[model samples]
Target: MRVTLKLATSLDGRIATGSGESKWITGEAARVEGHRLRAGHDAVMVGVETVLADDPELTVRLPRSDEIRQPLRVVLDSRLRTPATARLANPGTMILTAAEPRPVGTAEVERVEAPDGRPAPAPALEALARRGCASVLIEGGGQVAASFLGAGLVDRLEWFRAPILLGGDGRPCVAALALAKLADAPKFRRVSAEPVGDDLWERYDAIR
Candidate 1:
């Protein structure tokens, strides 16, 4: 699957404040562009922590159009901790978990082999690919982003940066990759950069 990682953050690459308040990190235009990006992808994904914290709908909210097919919403819940009352626990949503399959509202539950408790990025993407997802958009908290990048599965990156600054105490856009040296870091080549209202939109492709 073609995996694309999307990040909307402050100038310092912080996704949220120290208290985890992440709403409206970018301008309206950037958010609209985000929805557009979702419309282009076959599936949109996030981690369980994001669901527990934000409870986002993960749906395309743009004006109704024939061309817009709401991408499948996916949550990586290794322990099946996703609440049934969560906004994403509905039809068209899928929960990939390592635990036994159980009902989470009307959403589909698929049990995947997660040996290390968390579902590895390659296997998770393989499962999505088997489900007919040619392209997947990972819109996440932090750990999920790091997992994909660390596994060398991310094909493209769509980043939106606001003008505001969140200090070191703020939540980072990506979690620790555990790279021992600078040369081991995942590299990406800049594809494009443009302004989206008060935010800047940057696009990149994996340098592999």
Candidate 2:
């Protein structure tokens, strides 16, 4: 599947404050553009920590249009910790977990092999591919972003950066890759950069 990692953060590449407040980091235009990006993808994904923290709907909220189809929502919940009452626990959402098969509200649950307790990116993508997902937009909370990028699965990046700064204590957009050398770092070639209201939207494609 074509994996696109999307990040909306502050100028310092921080997704949230030191205390975890992340609402309205970017302007309305950037968020609208984000929804458009989601509309273009076949599925949208996030790690379980994001669900537990933000409880986002993960659905496209564009203006009413018959052409708009909500993408399938996918969650990487290895331990099956996502509560059934979460906003995403409904039809059209799928939870890929490594835990024993069981019901999670009305959402579909699929068990995948994860030896490390966390579902690996490649196998998770395979599961989505089996479900006929041609493209996936990974809209994150750090660890998920790192996992995909570290696995060399991200095909494109759609990053939105606001003008404000959140400092070193703030939460980063991507968790550490634990690279031992600078040459081992995953590289991306800049595709485009443009302003979206008070935020800057940057696009890139994986160097590979």
lDDT of 2 by residue, 2-62 (tens): 9999999999999999999999899999999999999999999999989998999998998
Clashing pairs in 2: none
- Residues 74-178 of candidate 1 have per-residue lDDT tens digits of 999999999999999999998999899999999999988787899888888888888899999999979999999998989999999999999999999999999
The estimated TM-scores of all candidates read 0.97, 0.98
Candidates in order have lDDT scores of: 0.94, 0.94
Model 1 error, position 28 (Å): 0.2
Please report, as a residue range, the 10-residue window in candidate 2 with the lowest summed lDDT.
Answer: 61-70
Candidate 2 CA-lDDT value: 0.94
> Residue 118 CA error for candidate 2 (Å)?
0.5
